[model samples]
Target: MTATGGAAEAGQGPDQDPIRRSYDTVAQEYADRIGDELAGKPLDRALLTALLEQLTDPRAPVADLGCGPGHVTGWLADHGARAVGIDLSPAMVELARRDHPSAEFREGDLRGLPAVDGEFGGAVALYSLIHLPPAEHRAVLTEVARTLRPGAPLLLAFHRGSEARHLTDWWGHQVDVTFHFLDPDAVTADLTAAGFTLRAHLDRAPYPHEAETDRSYLLAVRS
Candidate 1:
């Protein structure tokens, strides 16, 4: 699933938004293929555990923003956080709910989240921000900050680069989505401007079986 905004209005309007439509079209296949991806990424699990550990109230809801098939969300729940998965695609949300009944999933936009101010204890946006254009990065981050409590931990992962990749076809299905490779320094600046204080930043080369792009992870706290 994908989480994005700045291109259209909120709510389930996939017919009007190419990104949502594309994800909806491939939601099932994406879940089938990527739902268990975290099993192979030890660093991802470690970071997620760190995020949960930092939350002041472990019972307070932790949002898995742009949570595709709810695998990460379910992982957080299993690890003791009250995890809620939010995605822009209705189909993705449906599949997440169907597969991970213990965790809650909602259909919402990243730019305009369907959450009240300071509703979440912490949040994670793994590879979700790449779907958004650079100009809208801070806006979405600001929205995320608005929904998180002060000092709430936020973990973000993205492709590390200065290039933008667009896909017109994926997994035998027609799609129109652009994945933005962001610079860690630029994203750190954006986090600061969005009311977050960076606590950790790490970059790593992709695993041989993974996409051929460098990856960056940032751990920040709402301030």
Candidate 2:
């Protein structure tokens, strides 16, 4: 599945946003180091497999919202789903373009997607939502719902917690970004309120050598 978003709902949106710039500062390094990261994570791969199976149109592009470096977007392609990866960072889009020329990457924001209503067949947000403040979750999900076909599946992976963490540096690069950990119930409620049929909510302990935080995977269908 793919996830999608536009740079902003209005004009005050994602372009050059701190999160975008933060990722931009490390875009090439991130792409070289962790872009193809799903290869080592079994659960993530399994979830994507399930997502791929649920897509209604095999040839249609899936939206990858908050698609950093377009790795997950390419992963979707590896599994046979056409994908369009969207990010707020132009540098990330450029790295993704360089790495996976076969896929499409655009600079966008999750609050508003540029696509026509129901433009996608499926969507995925792999840890992308973690960057947004909780208050924006529903608005983003609402935009998600608007851009997807009815009953289209959405797969989400996120860190689980009760607060947001701000990082001043990452991978040895100076940066400013906030990561939000969320409760599954709250996110599920947000999805329901945004016109989606909650499908599955799964959480797992972090594996060795992975980020030292619990993770949650949610599967929902557009209503």
Candidate 1 per-residue lDDT, tens place, 1-223, comes to: 4754211112345543888888888888888888888888889899998998899878789999888878888999888888999988888889989999889988888878889999999999998788777777888899999999999999999888989877899889998887788899999999999999999999888876677988999999999
lDDT at 11 for candidate 2?
16
What is the clash tally of candidate 2?
11
lDDT of 2 by residue, 1-223 (tens): 1112211111135433667667778778877777657778899889888887988887767988878888888888767778888877778788778888778877677776657798889998887777666787888899889999987999888888898778888889998777778899999999999999988888999888677998899999999
List ranges where model 2 is wrong by over 4 Å: 1-16
Q: Local error of candidate 1 at 4, Å?
A: 3.5
Query: What are the lDDT scores of the predictions, listed in order?
Result: 0.84, 0.77
Model 2: what TM-score?
A: 0.92
- After the best TM-score superposition of candidate 1, give how far the Cα of residue 2 lies from its true spot, in angstroms: 1.0
Off by over 4 Å in 1: 5-16
Residue 148 in model 1: lDDT: 98
